[model samples]
Target: MILGKCPYCDDGMIEVREKEVSGKKVKLYACSNAHWTTEDGEMFELRADASCDFRVWQNSLARYGKWLSYKDMKDLLNDESIEVELISKKFGKKTYYNKHISLNPEYGVSVIWD
Candidate 1:
């Protein structure tokens, strides 16, 4: 279990648990020793809850005609609400910006997000 640091708590990876409520069971990730909630009883998923961060960040960056550094990309990936492992398996590493050439020749060239 290689866990990334949680941005909100500035702590290490989150803890996962499966709990039963009513007649349904759901998986949730929370801080290692902290429970966060509002007076409204809203729940928050840990920083690692989703894997869309990569796509979100990358797509945003690419749309703005910018290239993200590897470290920045990693940060984006660590803050999603989905399983990054699964996301990685789908998108792989580099994205092919061009239908034929993928930001080759010039890595930082501006490109639109798919």
Candidate 2:
């Protein structure tokens, strides 16, 4: 699935790819024209060929283990107020708390705990 445009590159689009990490499959959002050789057929392959280096994990948009939708991400990017319930586990106990979520340039998303 195409998520959106790359925030770092002017003409690059963000595309979703499924990859295996540590024996588990996960989704990663990467720039369509990111760091890779023109000879490489796979866009997901990372190479130091001097291209846009913009990629983000799908779970990076998750708040408290809940994945946010594209609309939610767009809303957050627009500075819309959003309250998320964060699930916290400590010492084998589970608890929930509320937090405000926002988009971070370095990170895909961030939650305010304070």
| Model number with the top TM-score | 2
Model 1, which residues run further than 4 Å from truth? 36-114
lDDT of each: 0.34, 0.64
lDDT of 1 at 75: 46
Per-residue accuracy of model 2 over 36-102 as CA lDDT, tens digit each:
4434333445577646767666566454566666555445534545787778777878788877876
Candidate 1 weakest lDDT stretch, 10 residues:
81-90
What would the TM-score be for candidate 1 when compared with the true structure? Answer: 0.30
Where does candidate 2 clash, by residue pair?
none
**What are the TM-scores, per candidate, against the unseen true structure?**
0.30, 0.64
lDDT of 1 by residue, 1-114 (tens): 223454444544544444443345543333354443333323333244443211112232333234344444344335332112111123556343332112211231223233
